[model samples]
Target: MQRVRLVDVARDAGVHPATASRALNPAVVGEVSQATVQRVRRSADKLGYVPNTLARGLRTSRSYVAALVIPDITNALFPPIVRGAEQVLTEAGFTLVLTDTNSATEVERSQIASLRAHGVDGFIVATASWHDPLLDELATEGFPTVLVNRRCATSALPFVGGDDQQGVRLCVEHLVGQGHRDIVHLAGPSNTSTGRERADAFRAAMRDHRLSVRQTVIECSAYTEQAGAAGAARLMARRRPFTAVVAANDLVALGAMDALGSAGVTCPRDYSITGFNDLAFMDKLTPALTTVRVPFTEMGAHAARRLLEWIADQPPTATQSMLPVELVVRGTTGAPPVD
Candidate 1:
């Protein structure tokens, strides 16, 4: 089968190859008139024209590819982010390469090195530890990198994520409004920013509500369901007098539910629970989960766009872009059960 070429598109559009090239090129799409751009785009679509990314990369000294490094690809919270990023990158004529580091620092470093060796133009990392040395090194080396749904200790690099502190506050407030005064928190790992910030926020929010934080917070080793279950079990073993649990993420909340059920506790009947991330299928659960909804898709899209701006030698207007979050009420949260 004959591959469609730029010349054929230009011929069909009644324009020179150079004009069609400019019209089709994402980088210079603005240089051409909107009418001409529309015409050339229509012609290219009709001819099924696919740009030769390799050839274009060689000419521009760019791979036209970006790497999306995440902690765990299986986590449902990340798919929406990936979709959003892929959409923006695709529109910009760039391909997105996804890599999961399994929350390992060395693995993440090796993945970054491998992607760089393969000539990826930039990176959108969602696996940043609070004090990641690899990310610091990337910053030192002036790599075009954007952090999504996470941030480093230092504010040198650009990041896009939700307002973790505010999100936790909303969850706490909602539980409090439901008359849940004795609430426990299922915190995530302390190593990552999301874990640390959300945990800290939980404490602060609890304190702000004039509630005691002591003996009410249990940190999970990781964000996985296993960690959440263990945390919940530990909290239960302590015989803590709490009527609600605020999990750091949806996975943690699910784990908490598992633990509660095993202990013969019913959600919103014997106990109320709130989760973060508002991940997919939360509503479909036997008792719909009440969670904080982060703008995962927007965060991903913003990170991709920011990376593109950096790759184009344009500095971002802001160092950190924190999107807003909302508390999603569901069947899992209600007024505390009468003892």
Candidate 2:
């Protein structure tokens, strides 16, 4: 059998090829008559004519493609998130382009420029920093942008993340209730909202619970296993030893666990440890990790939806959503062992 073309379908449907093309595009669905649309659709089905997305988009000024900007795709936490985003966008007939800048600002800038040159319909940026100049420029340039799992100091952009304040409160309350009054929080860099907010929440939660934390918080330069190990070591070097450690991220917590192991310490028995994000392998560690579980997949789906809205020129109201978190009780957390 021979392949079908738009012209062949349009001729059978008693419409122009351009009219048939518009009917096939969801973005222009409203402009065409429903009866005519059904006719054109039937004709298309009979002919099995594949719509040329590139050609149609040239006529309609749409690419039906979105770019996802990731800081570090190698992180285990990102796979599920990307899967969720792609699942949603795929249903909407939008192609998702995954780009990693390795968390480098310069690389991110160049990549964003390249995506713009390719004419992406919008962007879902998962690498937002506190003061992201590239993000601001993109937003100001009127490109539809959705920030996933991070935020900027300025609230002009749509942001999605876990409830940091609530998650921290729950974590601190759990630690204090477990008889861990001397707890250390392994924090991320203060430059990003997740790091800054979680750190501040830790301080507030500690104060609210009347826990006396005698040591300074350990802020890792980046959210990586190596950084976590280094940061945990620094906290241990201080003169005072805390009975528990609450890590800002799972990698950091796992790193802290490694550091403790290297120093001949045991978790829950020697010092209770808790982590955030409940990433993969948390439960399979030497002692299962007790960490907060944030809905990474949900955040990704929400980001996809938000980006679609922008592509449709129906941007959501500039707002921030803080999803709920669950604290998983595992082997890593327990009552402070008797000295």
Candidate 3:
């Protein structure tokens, strides 16, 4: 079918094309009679006349293509964020072009170049390392890029991250409340902001609680299940009489759980544990993990919104967006075994 034009609706409604156009759009058409608005809508529905987003975008010099770049989509934490961003972008008359770097630096650079070459209006980036040279390179181009869950040290780039301090505070406080004193902190790779922030938060919370948490911090290779299991095993053998574990992320915590199971140690009876990001299936495990739930969806959507500001040639409202986090109390943490 040929593209439905406003003229068709105007001819059908016996009104001028401009009047029909004004009657159809909510902004200018509110002054038109409600009956006319309803009629235009009815005609539009009957004709299956969906507005052409590309034509409008081209006229405005806004291609309406938004880039959503992630480190790895295979991780359970990303699907919800993508779904939420797509919902908001669709309502705003924008298109999303997703790219995955698969955690490779060269691939990520190539992806960025491709997105920039394609004339994407802005970017919502969910991947950041402490020493990300690619982001610094992108920063010079004046493209609107919002970082999510990770950030560069410089204040120039905008970012959206979880309230990691609060999340770790809750986990530490919960462990303290459960009468644990010796806890192991499973630190993630320090190159990422999430890892560093959560690790720092755990230490601060522990000290603030006045708990003598004899901590043995082991840095994991990556936020992978195998790394977590290996780190947990090392901590178990290396630490002396530790009663609880606090992992930087949920993936690490699950790995720790597996290591503990292999050793035939019962969770909460022999030791309690905590994790972050509260991924799906956390509760279904033999002992449901107590974890922090970050607002990844809200952060993703906010990044999209901030990127729009860049596309509009306006400065982002804030350099960083810190979404709130909540602690989910589950089966993993409990009182230490009595003396």
Candidate 4:
């Protein structure tokens, strides 16, 4: 079978080869007239002509590929984010590559270096820590990078994430409105921005409601069910008198519930609880989870677009994009159990 060439496509589209070339390449397609670009694309499609990305990369010094770095691939919370970013990148004539680093800094560094060596154009990172040295290094090297769902404290890189502080405050406010005063917070690791911001927000919200700011924050080692279970168990060991638990995320919330149940405690009967990030099937749980809904898909889409803009030399003046969140009321939350 004869491979369809650019000249044939140009001829079929009734345009010069140069015009067809510009039309087919997304990076330079904007230079061509819209009508001509459409015509050329239609002709290429009809002729089954595939763009030679390798040859084009050699000429333009760009692979037209981007990398998305995530902390864990197994987490249900990341699928929507990946879907959103993939759609945007695919429409823009770019390939999206996904890599998970198991939330390890050394693994993240190694994976990033490998991706860069492979000639990926830029990165959309969701694995940044609060004060990541790798992020600072990437900034110093002038890499085209955008952060999602997390941000580095010292790096100047642009970030796209949900309003974590607002989410936590909303959770606290909702629980307080339900007549729960002595609430404890199950927090993620302070090394990450999401953890720090949400923990701080919980404290501030409690203070705003005139609740005591005592030793109410129990820090989890990670944002996993195991960590959450251990944290909850540790909290229970202290025999703290609390009526509600504000978990860092849905997984943590579920773990806390499991731990409580093991000790013959049940949600909303013995204690009310709320979680952040209304992950899939939260409503399907035995006792439906009440949580804060962050726009994960929107965050991913905006982060991809922002990374593209930076790659196009249109750096955003704003350092951060904080999407809004909503509080979802469900069966897990209620007025504090009658004493």
Give the top-scoring candidate (lDDT): 4
Number of clashes in model 4? 0
lDDT-wise, the better of 3 and 4 is 4
lDDT of 1 by residue, 3-92 (tens): 999999999999999999999999999999999999999999999999999999999999999999999999999999999999999999
Q: Better model by TM-score, 1 or 2?
A: 1
lDDT of 2 by residue, 149-261 (tens): 89988647888888988887888899888888888888988889999999999988998887764564888998888888998789878857688888989998888888878
Candidate 3 ranges with C-alpha deviation above 4 Å: 9-42, 212-215
When sorted by TM-score, best at the front, the candidate numbers are: 1, 4, 3, 2
Query: Can you give the TM-score per candidate against the true fold?
Result: 0.97, 0.89, 0.90, 0.97
Decreasing lDDT order of the candidates? 4, 1, 2, 3
Q: What value of lDDT does candidate 1 attain over all alpha carbons?
A: 0.91
lDDT of 4 by residue, 204-240 (tens): 9999999997999999999989988998999999998
Relative to the true structure, how large is the alpha-carbon lDDT of every model?
Answer: 0.91, 0.86, 0.81, 0.92
TM-score of 3: 0.90
Superposing all C-alpha atoms, what RMSD in Å does each candidate have to the true structure?
A: 1.3, 2.9, 2.8, 1.3
lDDT of 3: 0.81
Worst 10 residues of 1 by lDDT: 313-322
